[model samples]
Target: MIVGVVSDTHDDQEAVAKAARLLLEQGAELVLHLGDIVAPFTLRRFSREGVKRLIAVYGNNCGERLGLLRTAESLGYEIHDWPHVVELAGRRIVMVHGKGPAGETRELVEALARSGRYDAVLYGHTHEVDVRRVGSTLVLNPGEACGCLTGRRTAAILDTETMEARVLEL
Candidate 1:
């Protein structure tokens, strides 16, 4: 299964649409947003046709929490809580915004990735794209989808079968 990973989309509608289009074109069955989605309208980009699911978590900047939830509910989507765990294609994929106590440190994140607790640890906060391996787990961050801080908008496509991640620049 090919899953799309996105994060830190600080309400850049164009960037979000672009990333979603690319991911859908690339045959992404499911799309996961790591957070910082800002507004509910921005979340609509992930609801593109052909995408099976659009799941998200709140980031530090998601001020309109109620509106966000309402928008998602109206759209038949789900916004999970932090450190959301999802099973895709038989892989234990963990999604988080990389905030709070569980993901504040690189060491802690690495430890979680290497703890044999999950197959993939997906997060975003630093606005940098990274794909690394710790023990048997895959640690992936799709960077800033809005390019707000990094000046480079990006996302990633992860293949559950091979555990390979391909970063996409938008």
Candidate 2:
């Protein structure tokens, strides 16, 4: 299965639209938003035809949690707290928003990747793209889709069959 990973959208409608299109073009059947979605309208941009499921976790910046949750439910999507875990394509995956100080978040992400409990750990918050393997697990942060920081809007495509992923500029 092809899974699309995005993080820190920060309410950029255009970037989110482009990213959604790009992910569908890349044959992504599932889409995961790590966090910083910000608004319900911006979150709706990810509701595309090709994506079978959309799951998101709460970021520190997500103040309108109730609205976001309502919208997600209306769209048949899911909104969860941070560090949510699920099995997909026969692999255990943990998703988090990467809250806390920058260094601490990075350390936590790496720790989760190295803990040997999950096949993949997805996170965002630093607004920096990180895709690497820690031991046997895949750890990825698709960067900031809003392009507010780093001036680069990015997303990621993960191929579950091969356990490979790539960050793409959007």
Question: Judged by TM-score, which candidate is best?
Answer: 2
Q: Estimate each model's TM-score.
A: 0.92, 0.96
Clashes of each: 0, 0
Which pairs clash (backbone N, Cα, C closer than 3 Å) in model 2?
Answer: none
lDDT of 2 by residue, 7-94 (tens): 9999888888888899989999889999999999876777743445899999999999999999999888999998999788999999
Scored against the true structure, residue 59 in model 2 reaches a CA lDDT of 96
Give the top-scoring candidate (lDDT).
2
Task: Give residue 164's error in model 1 in angstroms.
Answer: 0.7
lDDT for 49 (candidate 1) = 39
Least accurate 10 contiguous residues by lDDT in model 2: 43-52
**How much is the lDDT of residue 5 in candidate 1?**
91
